[model samples]
Target: MTELMLKYFRKKQQEVQTEKIYDTQCPFCSMQCKMQLIEQSIVSRKQYKTVGIDNPTTHGRVCVKGLNAYQHAFHKERLKYPMLKVNGEFVRITWEQALEQIKDQFTRIQDEDGLNALAVYGSASITNEEAYLLGKFARVALKTKYIDYNGRLCMSAAASAASQTFGMDRGLTNSLAEIPYTRCIILAGTNIAECQPTIMPYFEKAKENGAFIIAIDPRETSTTKLADLHLKVKPGTDAALANGLLKVIIEENYMDEQFIQERANGFDEVAEYVRSIKLAEIEEITGVSINQIRKAAITFGKEETGMIFTARGVEQQTDGAAAVRNFLNILVATGKLGKLHCGFGAITGQGNGQGAREHGQKADQLPGYRLIENEAHRTQIANVWGIHPEDLPGKGVSAYEMMEKIDEREITGMFLMCSNPVVSNPNAHFVKNALKKLKFLVAVDLFISETAKLADLILPTSSYLEDAGTMTNVEGRVTLREASCPCPGEVKHDWQIIVEIARVMGKEKYFSFSSAEEIFNELRLASRGGIADYYGITYERLRKEGGILWPCPELDHKGTTRLFETSFAHPDGKAVMVVVPNKSVVPKEEVCSEYPLYLTTGRVMSHYLTGVQTRRSPALAARNIESYMEIHPTTARKYQIVDHSLVKIESRRGSIIVRSKYTEEIRPDTIFVPFHWADSQNVNNLVGEELDPVCRMPGFKLSAVKVKPVNDVNI
Candidate 1:
């Protein structure tokens, strides 16, 4: 078996060598790993090692995916040219013919149902220029209010929560370097080990310095292994834990009175409400011991410098927006804000996820991190576009909401760029039907992925290696570069294709630009003084000086490492302490015995999110070839499940058949599954469409499900 596996791996590697260098950023979970090419003859392949730049923020280190990026880039299954699906068959077609077909179909849709009948979807994996042009084409050309990206699934809740409290929805207050300087770090529902692997070293170093680490999660994760105190609260009970922690801090007089009185509002009401809830009640609601909660509170209240980090796990809950608001309350009560190493930070999932939103790809936002609905922000964008502020649409439906609207026929057409929602979206069944219901669906991708297969038109685009663009990392550092390889076949860059499509549709005025460099330059000029500062930044300077951190306002001004220190940008110049009462979204009311075990999904080291790009790669496939569940041995025994045994994971929403690997790493009532599976064993098939009220993000982390041995002979 080993020999056979090695032979197959070598054969795939040989085939990859013969292919052209497809330089593109890894489309996995947003590290946007950079790649360099030095391919020798196809027969005797030669490649360069992945290298990390001396980033001002990250120093010079990448995670496992970045190191193995070349594998995904040179995968054999990568779509080589444009292909048309006719009568349930994908046939290769010329770029001209495909473009012509798309133009005709799109024109027909507009002529039939007005521009509002068509919708355009962008992706976080796309370049800033591509994302910007996509929104522009949809709004300016198509004149459609339906436009958004998949980042809504990752950070929309957190963004809405932050804006409601702090009046800004930026990524984070400090970079990963701030971890080493923190005296107390509260990791609320963020598992950095499996998600943001590159930032873990700083967390480890902070522990060495005696920094207190607190983890608030339903299940103990790899990040929790290093926690000084782990509050294993019940699922969707984060607000309860946060409220309990706040009550303890206030009752024990651990809060900073002077800071609270000076830089905050609504404290009296917040304190009054928090004081009403005793520690005992908090313990009952959150399922965390009061003593542990008190210890975590004391750690935060007593520390001189404290930081709080949240991820999708915290924001994907039904009460996610409330959980985020309460987290800010803890920071405000402890006086952790306005400091070099203290404040609230969000561990965003995508590499260009932050940049994607900043560049105006979102339905609610415009370029320069400005709100599309805000008069001033609209005026800013209008000035850039030489149009009236009213030209842009108000905030459109978010991703999950959009999917629901698709079934309702509120949205008729969709133009997807560099995103695969068929497998990645929560409640895959609903997404599949929604795509099928669309009057027209145009897909732009590097391969004919699951989502691509659902499209009426597919536009083959250049990979990261064949395009020139800038990608911003999680730390808010922006890197600029050129493509390493030439474009394969007639595949064009995303920006070029978007421009051409708009031009062919008689909207050439909106896409009058020639290159991505010009678009980037104009965007940088527009982003001045915003949280994502680029006033002093230029493509010429970045290409020569490497990437720079945001808030680089002027050439003389040094890039800011810490933000909102002296005072806030809000009207009152004070942060609000929103007293989020201890509330549970999933009481016995939400889930029942029919769907018993709590199931959570995340990424594995061997594969990336959805696995469309990574699974095609031979190296990644060799690492993790099959889909399996990580079930606690205790639960496995109860269900009579053994290691590598075929099992059916059934939920009220749906069910999937996958192999099981019994282990004690997870809790008995909890089962862990990676979202990387995309074929027969795709775990998302069983995930429900429940969402957080404010952000409208689906609850991908928490779902009740049952597991049983696959007894059928077909298995």
Candidate 2:
């Protein structure tokens, strides 16, 4: 360890002398498993070991990602100080110099090209306090409408669908504890066994209790192995399969007439539209048997209580919003929701994906899921911040659209924090080019991520363990993140960085804050009357109750655990039944003689999104060193490719070379690649930039490509 490391750890040790263990939540996924970091001394270095804590979400279970999270704080590559790009080379700089440069550049951009030239991109991993402050800083200090976060890439499709159908956007309608009591579960798109391992116990328990599980995917995963039935649907055809299931439920007279007539609207139109599709046509489009579709529909419709859960597999496509709505159609038509242990939801991927979308981080949203275009909402938030409604900016484009127009001079400058778009964005090669077209770029992170490498200014920020705040999990539960460790060198909390920048920009009146707790108090005032109300929550209450769900409007009110038990959030007290058409599973770059295979991207068990922080951990990196393509044995044989053979995958967007792992788990006409690697192994290079019409989510799950043995091609 270096002198700086020793100084950092010694200070942290002194602060927590009376307490040997500090409780905190995992920084990886939405499970938010509770864990205790026990202090340890190794030679001259101070270390902490992660142990599971008894909590409602995980019941004292921890995943590999949670156990290895401590390794990130002391990694050799951790950024310790601020730096500036001088003549294409990064040079050490003071915080004063860095903030001054950012303020000057922001002022110059706004003066020269107008406020639309400035933008800020936040993260979903940070606390709700930080996310809220970042949004305020963007709208008030920088006065720019172009502000968004990485959650747009993860859960925007589901959010859009849920809001339009249910009058709100929450990932789950009930808690994870209720999974075991459900009679049936329709698991689609998400492989919870690998992506969120802690939640797998609930599914296992449900299966043991005789609950029928239907796993729908194009590949056989750990999740599929646990299912009673696996529907190998073709990529981009999820909406069609869902529509087919709805048709089967209607034809068999499984529709609950009372529920449809009293608790929902627009069912007759949806039924009429689904009746036009034949089961055989759906089988041809989705590559699933008609019998299998009928069996699954019967299981779902006949069950007294059931649930439907979806994830990125169906949420990252061109028809993602429609696919999600169609899945909900079955639940609404069969009277499956608004009952005990029955609902439909999307499994959120990020740590604070639910909270980030609920707050003002999204381009078209205000605090507490309020629309930015709504004059009343703008006035409410503006009043809390001591500003007029007219001072607030209007809605801007989504994350993908913002990046797409960068080269066209729509976005000239950006402030990026805690997000690495270079490794995570679709059509990464084009994103790289778009980033370069920006006149100025500032990145605030704990390490020099791939996206930070392109920044003109890099500001060192504290990690989750070194900061204290609250985070909302997938179930809409807000939990606490304890500041267990000390920030090294001159690193500062993200909220403090935004505050200092705003002060430097002559917005001190609005940005004044002594602590994160103070910011949370203000956030509660801003969210009092909105959909995701947080007025009743407090730091003391969270510590005493473990975690609290949203819509706790009064101080005496307990948090709501299950929503829509009797009535929906809509003024009419009913859910909307949308009639979605069965669209074809065709990519913009269709398969041809040159490119005959379908390519899809996903995550692996050992790493999180983009592998920015996980890649630094020796344990995680050792488990998977580089990206590999998974191909069916028959496809490999047809291409003259053997197991572990190097292959070059070419698409209309770009190409990448990766080692092929032959397996029978995947479909014969499609291949799978993990999108966690950067540089030469980046799978996003081969992904197209097509956006979903409703949510603007990039179609990352489908791209037409062809594979060739590396030996047959020259380097």
Candidate 3:
């Protein structure tokens, strides 16, 4: 980490070279939306711009966010060198000083409180290789049992549902190419219009092909416009609604008895549970008419081939995993799986959400999505890491639990990697307070994010355009992100940064990765024989095919586009249809006299999660300058609030003031807020600290709040 070592370690690109174009992807969402980066170089400077490319997943339709993805790298606030917290203010420092100090502080913390005292909070936005390296660095060099990622907030509930229902976790059960031919499509909880605008064409094509589309949400979004039937299901009643669908499907005799008998387990329990769910009760709980519910069930249940999609809005509930499982129960009962045009998928939100979670970044997982506590899985990963099986740490607590540990002083230090939890985590103020309690915090980011500003030391990392690694898109397509240009200044790829720190700490024996590809080579070996199975996915293959889906276990094996083509991943070659009783489903918060409105949070088309990167784009920044609460016109009238007027919204946890926009786009008793700003404008400031018991995913979507009118404002 010394400047001398860094001088030797870093290679500068020579005098101006011929301009070139490289195939890459946008850094915003899981569409990873394929794009071309045109790089213009002058000496040590690089200016890059993005152009959308045709692909099966997005079909060349990149959003405004994707088109301006490269702007953040050129932002004035981008970190050019490591910065040390000197006398409560960040000051430029050599990499040597920062890393040496971090080593000393971390070692001292571990000596005082044990190895688990230093935890790692990773990101779903980092590449697969970097995610693998992060897991290895923690378990091998740092020897800590605490490591988790941002995906716990985005996809953990859906992931848990997939693994429980299908015996494996892949973002999509089938490819995006097959969507057009489906007989029906059910979109539950996902807002495709804003979050995944690029994939809209696929569903539109399905509509053209005479397919029926059903949308379920608490709000009427752009996606609802495309649905033949829109079920405005009440927030937190996802399980009840799903149970109602199953009940109607059974009563209508639409269940595929032959398929269930041959391909699944626990169906009898599922059937028994649904038998007790009455449509009237479901109507009361979900706030959807019984007739509409019956019609939707009949439409989808009678279809021979169709798909069901779920996202964070529905999966971030207290019974999130169970709610997802309930949807899967409908899928299994319908038998619209294991083939083309018949599938289930959880739309991913982060750039590397699917890939990062598969490669050992989660607290209870190893590479290949293997369980950490399983002896055989532990031994396999231990052998690949060149460490004893006993040396591997046991399952650690989740991301939110780590915060509690920090508050208790059990974890005094943390390495925050590429995520801005201060603004993204539920109960933002509480997370920030816990972060303040940490004895040492090192944040890796390209700019001064909300969390980075609070770090004891901040390290500069290369942007997605400056790094070459593999990413798995929403359809489970693993594509390579070719570096469009080299890292500028003293910035380094995250993998390189970790490797240098490991070498400096004298753990080079296990952390000496020369490049991203080298780390990927080891990743393939580590992933062998496990459920996610990335052993056969090579960089060359990724380029040749544009992308390849996983479970490709042999060099000559073709990748699996449809995960459950024949048999399930469970030991018995059958999926377990988890029976979730509707009576057990209850939200952590409820609408009371004080907090009478149901508050839901989501994304706007112009901004992405945490908004650290997209907010830098002049085009996007101009489109959306700040966050606003979307209140129904009727609801706004009740509080004496007018259109485009500033208002204060308060929850049990906290409160924030924001401009209010009155529209009829949402439910009368509900409020919608976009969580992309900081300070008083941050919507997450009012979010609760409730987490799902199974996946440990925070209930970020649904909360209870009260609104009061403030100063008048208009857009």
Candidate with best lDDT: 2
Indicate the TM-score of model 1: 0.93
- Which candidate number maximizes TM-score? 2
- Predicted structure 2, TM vs. truth: 0.96
Model 1 score (lDDT): 0.77
lDDT of 1 by residue, 235-316 (tens): 6778878888898889889888998898888889989999888889988777789889889998798888999988877887
> Which residue window of length 10 is worst by lDDT in model 1?
18-27
| Candidate 1: regions farther than 4 A off | 1-43, 529-531, 584-589, 712-715
Predicted candidate 3 versus true structure: per-residue lDDT over 1-715, tens digit per residue: 8998776545443344647887678888898888887777867677676788877577688888888877887788889899999999999999999889888998999999999999999999999999999999999989999999888989999999999888888999988889989998999999989998888888999999999999999988999999999999888888889999999998889988988999989889888878876789899988999999999999999888889999987898888999999999998898888977999999998989999999989999999999999999999999999899999999998888888889899999999899999998888999999999999999999998999988999999999778899988998888888886667789999998999889887899898789888999999999999988889989888878778888899988888878777888888888788778664344568799999999999999999898898888888988989889998988898999988878998899888888889888789989999998988888888888878889988888888999998753222
Clashes of each: 6, 0, 0
Cα RMSD of predicted structure 3:
6.7
- Which lDDT value does model 2 have at 53? 86
User: How does residue 544 of candidate 1 score in lDDT?
Assistant: 68
